[model samples]
Target: MSSGTSNGEHRYVIIGNGIAGTTAAEHIRKADGAASIKLLTNEPHPLYNRIALPPFLKQKIARQKVTIHNEAWHAERNIDLMLEQTAVRVDPLAREVYLASGATLPYDTLLIATGGRANPLPNANGLQNVFNFQTLDDSLAILAQIERSESAVVIGGSYISYELTEAFRSRGLQTTWLMRGPRFLRRVLEAEGGALVDRIAGRHGVQVIHGVEIAEVRGQDGKVSEVVTSDGRVFPCQLLGVGVGITRNVDFLAGSGIETSSAVLTDQCLRSNVPGVFAAGDSAEYYDPYVGHPILMGTWDNATNHGKIVAQNMLGGEVPYDDVPTYSTTLFHNRIMAFGATPESNPDVEAVMWLDEASESYRRLFFQGERMVGGVIIGQRKGFPKLIDLIKQRTPIPVAEREQVLAQSVQ
Candidate 1:
């Protein structure tokens, strides 16, 4: 952590050094140059893109390519950055934060952007060769294991699992994907989308096991060898990758007056229930103007947007963030994009789809009567902008024109 003397002057303290906190620091510096600004983070390195870690693992990209900013960039702006320092507790009433090192720092305004941690496997300690993909450290650790092993078993069916499986396959490792659900990406993608992904993974020689759970991971000499499933099945692998899910990093704010349910509740302006306290990124559950309720979006885009909004609000500007939620992920040769709420989340919706199983191209437009509610596009990224516009504008595309619109060039 960088050393800085605390003064009695008004100060802004931001926790979490991801995109949210970094962007907030920049915006605050721009709006109020003289305001004392200090940023604390648990990570040792400068802010980097967590989304690009998969490509980095596959050797398609370098670590330097994923960094958002360098140390010199933050230093030039006069932003105090405290790296590898964890905020253990928050005294909202006292307007101070207690670090793990026993240092108490005061703040006139606070931004909580701690994000989320990778969910652990149930009875993880009893299991051997279990792993999770979340931070840079985790990615590096998994990459090391991949380099040393030939066969791997992945437990989970989310996008992270899909990406990691592809990475393993690209490196010539025999990969097995074990899922408890019937399909991959069950939470984000519809049945058709999940099937398309499964087909793509299968084409790449990935063994996918559906409706199965790993009961125990058997290993020898502190290394994994085989996994026993609940269905009386045994799969042998040298490595295990677990992508169960994520839980928001809000445990530190347990007794703080800030309101939280699932995540720290914030208004459209990114301000918490407690004045002068703001939240952004995965740790913040904010009300979306489109959805009309507090929703948790753990996307990088949402984190950046929240940082900008919270910075403006902290500087006495009344800027409310009402952005159309969007998220995308790439696996092997397939590109998937989703916008707004999923169809499962909004049951009062109908879909207009254009599917060509032969070409492996699919597009589904979600609607609530005449208004477009959301959309999912697989194998075609060009369709994202137009679909996003349609959802944002609430534009109605006639059932007959759905195919024509999707075929037309977005450019």
Candidate 2:
């Protein structure tokens, strides 16, 4: 198949309407006015804010507020919006995408942004009151269940689990946080960091048990009633929130020759091994030039930036993604911020840490040689912006000045 149509106009087909794919579609329309753009998503609704779902669950925001774009928005830009269409196969050689609905789409350049599916756990299948908090629909169903729930159990140790913990506690549900790992963010934060999180959750009246896995869930009347752990302990609850992890949606590319490890493997340009095929968002594990390795960051900011950069590259620009990725969110009443590479993601880097139990604050800086690569700050936000600048510029800090930098950052 030819790359372009008979008249030379380009065809762009993007899968997944998350921030990554949607942003790419928006920018592509801006740059190439005449390009035929088709945006696809398996979801039934238009583009919505996944980040806001937590707040919506807490009744801080209305359901409609979570939506970022309406169908009319795509119509205004003359972009074809295809919803509830799951791409089942990709014929990269023929530049065609086969959908589950028996529809075929041909593209000159294709962007695979089908983000991910929530990883399911055993006993969660076909079970009522057991939920995965990954989508707007999940959150909505959870919100409805919360109205009838008196107790909640949150599983996993990732950010999603933390969000579930906070939401349940905020709603006055007797909440129990369960994790197989010893602590939260086990890979990124140390024991002291985990203790801080425990203290925060405790202050909010949350029961946190660690190093235990879910053995079996006991239900009554087709609804979850209690959970039994591997250690043979049982905790009664009306709702279960599972945030184990996510499986990147790349199964359709199984034989399409798209190189994938944890996700679609792309270079700094966000281009897959095959020409004219690109990836973005959580689906793309692109090589990070700054970190000197391939990394997958699934933050909204990272995905949004990926869309912008990938759009330029898909339009024949050789631009490489260089944005510094950062994530900042509120935990209970405190702030948790992390940016760039961390000890969890890159073990080769050396780390320095400081903690103050009285103030409930902690800071850890990661260094490679003399340059600051990444850092995590919990509690205070005094020097977060400065640290981002230092990492972005690759500023060098001498060993003698390392402690001084940390002390001054908090002030």
Candidate 3:
């Protein structure tokens, strides 16, 4: 039947209870006090900080520190929290959402913040040791295995895989990191930065294997023991972590009217082509005015902004979503941050590099003609704020003055 709320203060149904969905629910309540708001999530937990998950996975922090909102928090707000349920399909014409349990939920407004799912090995079957480090349960399970395991094979060279590689090596496990590319984050990291990452990984006890893909996952006693590469190299391991990235959680909207380009396509206002339908979080490719293009960014800051913008638009307010995307994390005893464009986005941008001793620390700033378009800062962040402002303001720096700018930036 149609359970869209008969009391009639306009029902809002949100899918996925991550940062984006939960934040949207909060803003919706603040905007309309009496509106019926219900949140549905496939995860049992209400809301937890996924950004801090790396440390949690490494067992550096207690599990309780990762959880932000609990069951009681949702109860006090009078928001219907449907846990362990997923949206199987969406009927835009009927304004109804169907769950796998065969229940139907009608809504006056719908937000598809389903985000993405962990992409796994192509031929991975029912195996006990292969794991993807995304959710809390996945992290907990990996930690438990880490406590007993002595060797780990991490596949994929993205940030997720590196985090796993760091954790395994830090815990004194014999770790081997495999990647399909010659370098980690090549699209984002400059050649020097990429080389630095390889150097750092090697120095930290991780055997960094480049330009290889796993062709087979062989197991003994139903647990993964070795992976054979496409080139016919076999690596033995007691545990495996795959970080091939995420598959956008938009497959359910295939027949729906919502347009999707790698993710749900939206304008600067976070509005989909279908009226009363909106998308946020990792699945929303909304316009980013700061970058002068429509881009999809999966970051804590991006999702947080999307929630506030969609909430305002859903309440009949006109506002534009603008942000300069950046991601910061510590890697192998070095602190690094990347802002603005990557090679995939701005391949031809001119660069200015400033390197420190041991080739271990440096910052590379990218520019398009006169305007700053991108940057990568390592081992130093005192100059990041000014550099980011230059990007936002489209400030032009003379070619001759670029070197002096970096020199004075740290001073």
Candidate 4:
């Protein structure tokens, strides 16, 4: 056995360096002090708060403040972090992970916390100022481009596109927000909330175009200049921000005995069908005890809590992960939050919504029968805690009184 391992100790290997993987490593060290832990990531930097990248990209905060756990912090925790190491393949039979550098790591228990990669626009070949806003590096490159570029085109109606729009607009760029949807956040937000986002974009001089596809990216002197939409509408832009969505990174798990779908399938305890192997974070489609179904949550708190629950289960604890996943973000000027299952997530659930058009504030509460299932809140955040509690406790509020309940809380 390697000197890192002892007779009674087992080697634990974790892939990826996001909050989920890093949090699991920290908890495992505290729970099983003697277990050998190895953490690997393609990123050179230590675990950082990716959620803070919005303000970082906007230049509202310094780069130093975005970092969470540093190298020395991981060292003090005794986590053997292998930076810039890419896992090329996994062998379930031999229980080994083959690195791109021709190295192999053997593990008794493995956690594939490998997250998702930002989906890119088609035909965006090596174009200058075209970026998918996801990582710190992507944000840094975008910030550098904003220093010289103006009049940018943002694609997609997702959160990343809004963040890119916010960053570019804050930098005094003439921004044009384009998407193939009717309004912003078409999949999650109700009509009032989405229209409020469009209004927010318009308030800042952002041209919000919907139901259009990118036909071509025209360049001038080897640099981006304008974009041609499929509808033949041409918009002049110097930068292109693509935030279509993310493709979960699970290609390395093929033939590794790990079942896969849109994400890695895990039970209520976050365990894979494969013994001694597990998955978490954005790539994990864990069975939700609250909803009584499998769900893929890509929120910071859900992933962080997944780390703790998975670690406990990895160490033989029967702790099931449970929480009403909430993803909160800002679009231009509106603070948008989605808690539990929205109408898009569960269309069968009934919805009660109130729109304060004067204030541009919107609140939506989703219910199943008499029990609160989930909700989406836009502009107002003060009553989010109560909505979450209603979902968690499955509070029974009659459909007739649903609006009254939401009204009282917001009031």
Candidate 5:
């Protein structure tokens, strides 16, 4: 972005102090000792582990353990951390960012890592006891509600909904998981995989209701009391956890020349269409060379890698992001893992599934022609590393031997 200028003279302005932005600032400072770096975040606190929020909600970890970086940490690195400041608009032509407080900051290069905001449930705003867990504050508030809550209702089939369902059930509350789809991860997992997850939830005493949408939220004294579905069935609860997914925070870039579709569109180098501008983290929809398409991934590993890789490109290096992103979680003593591009990410891939009801293990491998592209495993983590390596190598497996590959690990 800063041509002919020394690295020391470049001014880097990063929006959103999440892991991606913070990691970029850390690396930028390492390479360019005298570069002016400004990290802005609307949140009051510094970089905290969003992944740690679930354990914090379940009271498995103390509040202090959730924070990954404090203000002092930023100060020690000489990174100018701006807290509680929201970027309202960007003018690419002027290379300036306008803040919500009427202040403007000029930058030689800018990174839009603002990530995504949790999607709010309809007719649930302004009501107490209705929660969306996206931040430390949200987790804290939910913990307080759990102290007095006798029952909980969770909506959506996303990971956040599952987190709420698990946390509520762990706390011994009467928990019910409701979704409009017939199975969990309907787009990614087949009926066999979904049924395995349902059985695990059932074993943990969670009442899972399918094929229902919230018609109305009834409250008492401004606090949520019951949720009525479209089928006229009501589920009563003192707390409601909604995980309807998220919308990337790119509205401020609407008129800025930067391309955006669900997220900021970027090439393999994580460079936006506009000069001197780039995107990372959940706010980036970058081209994935492995899948031969651009997919938006919100996992911590993907975002962290984006920060490091994009920083090289920002420094005038042509580095393509080729990391294989994976996400793993435990469900009532069983494991669930997803790797690379699944049906949810790339629908064109063919799928082959393997199941063992007695051992409570199931796996579905996805293929693009003869090469493995992605996989999902539930209730078993035995063959995870091999599958990851296969996807990374894009290994071609003979159609006749595909079923043998599925059962090789456990057998």
Candidate 6:
């Protein structure tokens, strides 16, 4: 940690060093030059884009390129950054945070940007091969294993799993994807979109299995040899990759008096239920205007936006974050862009699909009556912003023009 001038004044402490926490620190520094700020992070390195880990593993980009900023940037701004330190507890009433090393720090305002942790495989049972893709260390370990192995078994069929499968395949490794659902990315994409992804994965020489739950990992000499599924099937693989999803890192807030449900519940201003406390990034379960319910968005965009909002609110600036939710992923020669709430989120909503299976192109429009709700685009990159605009403005498309609009390119 860098030393700062002893002004002997109240300071703001930010937990976590991801995009959200760093953004808050930057915003606070810009708002009040004299305000003291300290950022505590468990990771030794500076904030970097977690979403870019897969691309880095594939050697498509350098690790330094994904890093947001360097330590010198924080030091020049007179901001104290305590890396490799964990905040174990928070006393919300007293506005103080207790560290794992028994150091207590007082804060005039606190922001919980602790983010989320990768969900571990069920029945780890001291299995050595089971691994998750979340941090830089996890990616490095997986990359090393992929280089030494010729085959891998990946659990979960979400975006992370898809990326890992692609990474392994790019390295000349045979990969198998295990999904518990009937289709890949069923929660985000429709059947047609999922099918398109499945075909793409198959084209890359990857095997796909659905409706099977991994029961246990059988190992030899404390290293994984095979994985047994609930259906009594055993998969032989030297490497086991698990990407089940993530859980909010809110365990430290157990006695913080912050209202949490899967994640810390925050309002439009990014304020927690308790005053002088704010939450953001993957740990914040915020109310979505489109879905009209509290949902946890584990995306890079959400983290950055939430950080800006929380920072403004901390400085007594009124700024509401109500942008339309959007996310995109690329895999196996196809790109998928999705926004707002999917049709599955609302049963009353309906979707219309325009697909060319041979060309592997698909366009899905989700609607509630004449108003556009949410949808996805596959194998096409144009008109993404138009869809976002329509969703944000709640623009309605006439039934007759719906198909034409979906096919048109914005000028």
TM-score of every candidate relative to the true structure = 0.92, 0.97, 0.94, 0.95, 0.97, 0.92
Candidate 4 per-residue lDDT over residues 206-272, each given as its tens digit: 8899899899998888788889998999988889999998988888888887998988999998999
Question: Runs in model 2 with CA error above 4 Å?
Answer: 1-3, 399-401
lDDT of 2 by residue, 84-131 (tens): 999999998999999999999999999999898888877764679999
Q: Candidate 6 regions off by >4 Å?
A: 1-10, 343-349, 368-370, 396-411
Error of 4 at 22 (Å): 0.2
- Each model's backbone clash number: 0, 0, 0, 0, 0, 0
RMSD of each: 3.4, 1.5, 2.6, 2.1, 1.7, 3.3
The lDDT of model 5 is: 0.89
lDDT of 1 at 188: 51
Which pairs of residues have clashing backbones in candidate 5? Answer: none
Q: Stretches of candidate 4 above 4 Å error?
A: 1-6
Candidate 1, residues 1-411: lDDT per residue as tens digits? 122236444588999989999999999999877778899899888889998998998989998888878889889999999999999999988888999999998888889999999888875555445688888988888888888888988888887788778888988999889999988767556677678878988999998888999888888877788888879888888888888888888899989989988889998888899988999988999877655667788788889988888898888878988777777888568777777766544655676666668867777766655567677777756657667777778677676765566567233
Model 3 weakest lDDT span, ten residues long: 1-10
Candidate 4 colliding pairs, count: 0
Off-target runs (Cα >4 Å) in candidate 1 are 1-9, 126-128, 343-352, 368-370, 396-411
Scored by lDDT, the top model is 2
Q: Put down candidate 6 lDDT per residue, 182-283, tens digits, no spaces.
A: 887676567877877888989889999889988888988888888888899888888888888888899989977899989899888888899888889888
The TM-score of candidate 6 is 0.92
lDDT of each: 0.81, 0.90, 0.84, 0.85, 0.89, 0.82
Error of 1 at 207 (Å): 0.6
Rank all candidate structures by their lDDT, best first, as comma-separated numbers: 2, 5, 4, 3, 6, 1
Weakest 10 consecutive residues of candidate 1 by summed lDDT: 1-10
For candidate 5, lDDT tens digit of each residue in 271-302? 99998899999999999877888999888999
Output the better candidate (2/6) by TM-score. Answer: 2
Clashing residue pairs found in predicted model 1: none
